[model samples]
Target: MSHALNILKEVFGYPAFRGQQANVIEHLVDGKDCLVLMPTGGGKSLCYQIPALMRKGVAIVVSPLISLMQNQVAALNEAGVDAAVLNSALPVEEAQIVEQKLLAGYYDLLYVAPERLLTKRFLDLIAQIPLALFAIDEAHCVSQWGHDFRPEYRQLNVLHTRFPEVPRIALTATADAVTREEIIERLVLHDAEIFLSSFDRPNINYQIVDKINSKQQLLSFIQHEHLHDAGIVYCLSRKKTEDIAAWLNTHGITALPYHAGMSPHQRALNQEKFLREESIVMVATVAFGMGIDKPDVRFVAHLDMPKSIEGYYQETGRAGRDGQKASAWMVYGLNDVIQQRRMIEESEAQTQFKQIATKKLEAMLALCETNSCRRAYLLDYFGEPVAFTACGNCDICLNPPDSWDATIAVQKALSCVYRTGQQFGAGHLIDILRGNQTIRVVDWEHDRISTFGIGKDLPVKGWRAIFRQLIALGLLTTDSDSYGALCLTEASRAVLKGQKKIFLRQQPEHKKYLHKKQLANDCPILDQGAQQLLDQLRNWRTETARKHGVPAYVIFHDTTLMELVRMNPQTKDELLRVTGVGAHKLDKYGDHLIEILRIA
Candidate 1:
């Protein structure tokens, strides 16, 4: 443990372990297999990394993405750790060099994709070298039930069969109970000790708004709060991703589009720009974000609902990774629910899988509609206990939504559904309730029904909210047989018969809650002179990174730079005391930084 702590401080520039990092590292050092379930940016790497350094031989890390392997290897090397990566992206000669180095025991940590590691050539090479441990990153990929299931990950059981003596560690940022069990079973880690970190990311404020002029709302979010910050905006479709990216660019935000539809090189270049630039926003589908290791993402906005709570959690987890204040804003509408349901029903997955997917979507809807602490609701969904009723961070807790007796409104909506023979979706039902005399309404003679026009007091948007809440509460279900028409379940009978009273949030006017309060003092605030100093330091960092052909963060993180601004260290000795300034970094940049501080 002492050795690990020393490496952590001297190499990674952290003074101590966070949460359960020490315990996990200690267990791994003792040669025990382990499973770690931690949120993004919870330092999962340190759990395996310290053990690899302490053990007798090199550590082999099986990662699912080439970009992720490259990013980790780069960061490790920057921190003075001996690490290398082998993937298809590597040149043939370079791959041969890495293989030879591995055979000669020249590397401390070796990262390889699962497919490459499973190859006979690589397997033969590993057999010739002394083994330390196997670290399986993004371990949820092993679960067929997970959102990011990779078939190659399922065949990783060969690791246990071929190298029974090597300690193994599997780590994932997002996984529910089902995915967790599947990871353990598929990876043959049944005897591994499990370490579950708190899934809470307190720095990220969760906000979900009813979709209204979504593009404009997204623009407002960026302009008002995160104007100069880096963020990720997620869209459901590839076309939407491209459209939004172009839209954002026209609106004066530097944005890029990324999806599987684009060429691999294009996607990689866009991802690199997003990582390397300070304020570039990447609008992408679910294809992005799995391998992103950026710690300073200020926000993650979802223009559409994700497929499941697990997906939502993982996507939102990308924000505020540095433990700095960030936001996860989502705008979803009734159409999103219908689209998700239709996708699930029309999917090629088996009946059981479809049912599970439906339930997952339902849970996501529940999170959107809940008037409680968003953080608590999200944590509870992951089977973690929340000690408090309110998180004081989400929009609901901050604004405190007002609930009204929506019993009468719900009854009218349900009655309209039943009167229409449960054959109409929300649009038709809402039109019928709001007394819209459309051709379809008159053609079906729906205006003549007793429940028709009864909901004229509420507008279409209000009625939509009521129906969405009803669906979320399980009082109403979408029937795929009827083309996603509204159907009442047994729960709806109670509301219709006045046996259950439904209290729903009174739909706010103008969507004011979507605007989050700008956090004051979240980051280090500088005086006029110090602010200039900070700017100069950033400029220096950018130039240095350009010279070295690396991200500015690889030179120094924002937090470290902020610390330099605050401390205003005048000498190399004082600069070394900054949190992230280890011996290697000091020797590299200490003189230049001291000169800047002295001038400022």
Candidate 2:
């Protein structure tokens, strides 16, 4: 059997096993069951993948996503390993062929869906094989508390009970303490070794912006910061997904929308297009989750707020999965909070369940409003230590926002609601501030109300900011059933009565960058010939990766080339010392890159 560290270098192209990977691999090889709670991009696949190749028989991988399964299978095939996935997309003949391959021992790993486990034919076939291990990907879905709960996942214990001697490993990128315990119970890993890697990805910078012309803000961010990077823009609804995707396409971005509203063939086609293409952005909804396995996603932008932190974490984790620098950005507003609360309140869940869900939703809101180090807060929440309080990548860090005491402004807004019978939206009230004397105000004859036009002290934008912040802070609530008409919740009563203080942060004006001339001055690496060499290496890597049908980094990592830039190596022996350059890889690719460097 190959050593786990060596396997890391050979198959996955890493120089060393990340924290807990080696330990988990050892436990798996020793035929002990394990539950691994690794953050996304933390290399959870390696723990079972290495053992699958080294041990006696096929490793059955139960995966939740068909597209993700296909991506992984393609990657394995590119690495010169035999792998196949059985999913709904397969034809009868193709399914039989894969089944026959499994029985004939031609495939090292078999990716199957949970629904396939209960089939008599498949179970009988599995009984005949000398099973090496069982791997459950996205195992958090087994629990109702999890963001991506799957009813079929609860039936996975059959694999454990029937193949008691075989080792099992359950893996998930996002799971809190409750979900973790639920996965163990549902999977029946009674004696399994548990591997809990710190759920932290330091390379990702998290930022949340209060919703203001959110589409324009998204466009500006993409144009300025992520012009050449692969990204995913998440919307809460299909219409918005399509609209944003169309907007991006109109503005020279190669973008597509994927949601259940699209035809299945179109969804599959769009997903395939994203996987095969470079620098493409996918604008999608929550329906696009569970099966997306694209590495090197530069950023994940949430145009609308998610239902819970677990959902947000899992979605954002898709970025920086290659362990490179990436970002997570969100735009949120008062309407999102109201709609989310209404959904929770209307659900058939018991009061306790609703309370738990509400708490999680509030936590997500707090994450949005927090002005502290986005990275530090996120990492600390996931149970990790961060030495720095400011990460310098978020909106709060880049341009620290100033706050003003809005006690009076909030009182005016709330008083207007109280005097107007709590039945007006933001636009109607904003008109009163600017003294529009509109027809509605005239009909109500409310232009003479005590609080009418009282907010003239602040700009229209300022009022909008106060209202949004107030709504987010739970001091005011919007009645969504009434087309988002503003209302004073019980929490708002205190503020209107001057029993509490109100503070609102100032929003920054948007800056648009119109010239690429600044690009040459932006990257210090551009001045050096080494960067040109690195670009050539990346180009060659992309082409070579396309030829092999794998992610570009799988062939040779960017970190490795950046090291080469620093080391300026000219010999194969020298190149091997660079991180991520394995001996097997050195023998295969070292000469080519070394030759290119010499020419440069």
Give the number of the best model, judged by TM-score: 1
What is the lDDT of every predicted structure here? 0.89, 0.80
Tens-digit lDDT track of model 2 for 31-77: 99999988887878888999998789999999988888988897676
After TM-score superposition, the amount by which residue 306's alpha carbon in candidate 1 deviates from its true location, in angstroms, is: 0.9
Report the lDDT of model 1 for residue 399.
Answer: 72
After superposition, the stretches of candidate 1 with alpha carbons farther than 4 Å from their true spots are 509-518
Provide the RMSD of all predictions against the true structure, rounded to 1 decimal: 1.5, 3.4
TM accuracy, model 2:
0.89
TM-score of each: 0.97, 0.89
Instruction: Give the CA lDDT, 0 to 100, for residue 456 in model 2.
Output: 74
lDDT (C-alpha) at residue 392 in model 1: 80
Pick by lDDT: which candidate is best? 1
Model 2: lDDT equals: 0.80
